[model samples]
Target: MAKITYIENGGTEHHVDVPTGLSVMDGARRFTIPGIDGDCGGACACATCHVYVEGGWAERLPPMEEIEHDMLDFAFDVKENSRLSCQIKIDDGLDGLIVRTPPRQY
Candidate 1:
């Protein structure tokens, strides 16, 4: 499992141990983290799982795919670090990854 930190827009943080092979969205749902609704159930079909990769983790994550990129267009307050949580799969390499949720998801 990898330790992932999810920070809310208001500064609340949730640290969770996400099992390998699961998406970040899955971890959030498992832990009941707020701000990530994951309406598409990890299908990358919606923008409800939007998150901002913090620190250098954004560069460390795999390149964003076309589907996720397009989906993000529907998210609120998108930034350069913006990403769909469903597109981020957990692995040993992603240990200590930090992500911040937007103020709201649309």
Candidate 2:
């Protein structure tokens, strides 16, 4: 399992142990992390699961696909580090990943 840290906009952090091979959004949703709604159910159709990979983690993640990139544009508070959690598949390399959620989901 990998350890994922979800930091809310107000600075609250939720740590979860996620099984490898699952999507980051699934882990957040399973743990009930407040900021990631995952409205599209990991289909890459919605931006509600938007989050930002803190610091160097962004470089470690795989490049976003065109669909994910387009959906991210609809997310609130998009930034250089922004990503759709649904698009990130968890693995051994992603252990201890930290992602920060935006203040708003819309």
Candidate 3:
């Protein structure tokens, strides 16, 4: 399992042990972390699970696909490190991954 740190907009942090194969969105949902609604599940169909990958983890994550990139257009405060949590699958390589949710999900 990978240990992921989820930071809320206000700086609240949640450390979760997310099993491999599940998406980052899944981890947040499993732990009931606020700020990540994941309304469409892990289908990458919505921007509710938007987050900013922190530190060098952004470069460590796999490249964003066209679908996720396009979907991010609907997210609030898009940034160079912005990514759809549902599109980020957990693995041993991402053990120390850290992500922060935006102020608003709309």
- lDDT by residue (tens digit), candidate 3, 1-106: 9999999999999999999999999999999999999999889898999999998899988899999999999999999999999999999999989999999998
TM-score of each: 0.98, 0.97, 0.98
Q: What is the TM-score (0 to 1) of candidate 3? A: 0.98
- lDDT at 41, model 2: 89
What lDDT is reached at residue 23 by model 3? 94
State in Å the error of residue 54, model 2.
0.3
Candidate 2, 66-94: lDDT as tens digits: 89888887899899999999999999999
Q: Which stretches of candidate 3 lie over 4 Å from their true place?
A: none
Better of 2 and 3 by lDDT: 3
How would you encode candidate 1's per-residue C-alpha lDDT over 11-54 as one tens digit per residue? 99999999999999999999999999999898888899999999
Clashing pairs in 1: none
| Candidate models: Cα lDDT each | 0.95, 0.92, 0.96
Off by over 4 Å in 2: none
Q: Which residue runs of candidate 1 sit more than 4 Å off their true CA positions?
A: none
